[model samples]
Target chain A: MQFDVRLFALYRERAGASIVTIDLPEGASAGDLTAAVRADYPRLAPPEVRIVVAVNAEYADDDQLLQPGDEVCLIPPVSGGC
Target chain B: MIILTDEPLDPVAVTDSVRRDGNGAVVTFLGTTRDNFGGKEVTRLEYEAYDVMAIKKLQEVRDTLRADYGIEDIAIAHRTGRVDVGHISLVVAVASPHRVQAFEACHEAVNRIKTIVPIWKKEWFADGSRWVACEDHEFADEAEHAHAHAERHAVAAGD
Candidate 1:
């Protein structure tokens, strides 16, 4: 399966690209997407970091299943304020 | 009203929209860009938002506050792109039948927006710039991150 993930804030700055596409097995979970992103773009975060994931605008657990065309967003630690 | 705009925010318009009969008070919050941070001379600020998520979360906050505190009306407007010092970055307005719930609901609205909204603020210091609290509470350690995220969120909500 192919998944296109949206990036924001630090992840976009680090990755230097707003969207990343990852190829995975048919039954990939959010965790698998995280691992693949880490492997592909190490600069996005340190190896040990586990960034947040959002599926269709809602926070999704690491075990959440991925649909082929799901609108996934990679959320770094949010720092919203004045 | 819950909005994400790249244009300037008008607090008057936002607060006025929430005005209605039987509302005794309306509280509005304007989060402006400060001129300094930790002794650094700041020049301006840049804000970004996951528009879809941020707006959704803003609506969620309004709904939650209405149910939680029985507030009558609320409005939230956030700016995107670049914002200079002393300019408004956020506006949260709430109305209720009394003063207490108006203030309380507005307070909670601001708190919840920071904790959950996918908006980000980048501080532009004179010599350098940084994304405040971006990595300070995230991506450092695995075991303590859950706690740190919660604690940082508390700190954020408190502010």
Candidate 2:
């Protein structure tokens, strides 16, 4: 399965693109996508930092199964509130 | 009212939008761009967001506040794009029957928005710029500098 993972903030700048397409297995979970993104873009963030995955605009657990057309984005640490 | 806008946020209008006859207390919080950050002079701040998700998260924050504090009146407005120094970037207004609940709920709403909302800020200094809390390339260096500066300030105070 091919999934287009949306990147934001630092991830977007490091990757130099807003979206990156990756190929995964049929039953790949959200964790799998994270791993794949890390593998593809080593400079995106440090290994220790967790790359949060959001599906359909909500934070998804590691085990959440990603559908074909779900809105997937990588969220970095945020600093945007009053 | 929950809004993600590029235009300047009107605090008065946002506060008015949440006003009700039954509400006795209204608390409004505004987050503005500061000129200094960690000993560096910030020229301006730029914001970006995953718009669709940001709106959803703002709604979630409002709903959670109402559920937890029993405060039904809430309004949040956040700005995207460039915000100059000392300009308003965020406004959160809460109304409730009592002052305590309104204050508490408003505080919590800001905290929650910081954690969950899909918004990012970039601090532009005269020398360069870096995203706030990106935790990627520049954040580590900036963190160390901030820590060192803080320690220096503490030592100066002790002297």
Candidate 3:
């Protein structure tokens, strides 16, 4: 299956593209998508920071199963202004 | 009311929208772009958001506050794109029968927006620019802050 994942903020700036298409096997989980994104774009790797996955506009757990055509996003740490 | 605009925000309009004759207190919060950060002279601020998700999350904040505080009149407005220093970037307004709930809800509203909403802010300095709160340590700090906020909220709610 092909998933077109959306990127924003620092991730978008690092990836140099707003959207990237990833090829993943069917029945892949949201966690798998995150791994795939990092694998595809090595520059997106931030080992210390936890990048969250949002499936269809809601935060999705790692184990949550992904379906085709679902809106996926890579959410970086929000601006809390610490 | 939930608003996401690239244009400059009007706090008075948002506050007035939630005002009513029966309400005794109306609390408003305006988050402005500061002129400096960490002793670095800041030039401007640029905000970005996942628009659709941002609106949904903002509405969720309003709905949750209404349910928890029994306050129905609430409004939130956030600016997107370029916002210069001293400009308004966020506005949260809440009206209630008393001052306590109004103030608490308004405070909680801003916290919730910072945590859940998909808005991002970039700080521009004369030397360069940096994305605020993108660091790993900052995330950890925010988590701790959120934990503290949650505990305070629970205590305030008597939960």
Highest lDDT, which number? Answer: 2
Q: Which of candidates 1 and 3 is the stronger one according to DockQ?
A: 1
Ranking by lDDT: 2, 3, 1
Give the runs in model 1 whose Cα sits over 4 Å from its true position: B134-159
Question: What's candidate 1's DockQ score?
Answer: 0.48
lDDT of 3 by residue, B1-159 (tens): 889999989999999999999899999999888888767788999998998989898999999989999889999999999999889999999999899999999998987887788888888889887766533333223343533343233222221
Point out the higher-scoring one by lDDT: 1 or 3: 3
DockQ list for all candidates: 0.48, 0.38, 0.35
* lDDT at B131, model 3: 68
Clashing pairs in 3: none
Query: Model 1 over residues B88-128: C-alpha lDDT tens digits?
Result: 98898888888999988888888777778888777787776
Count the clashes in each prediction: 0, 0, 0
Lowest summed lDDT window (length 10), candidate 2 chain B: B150-159
Q: Estimate the lDDT of model 1.
A: 0.80
Residue-level lDDT of model 3, residues A11-41, one tens digit each, is 8988999999998999999889988988888
Q: Who is ahead in DockQ, 2 or 3?
A: 2
Residue ranges of candidate 2 with Cα displaced over 4 Å: B134-159
Best candidate, TM-score-wise? 2
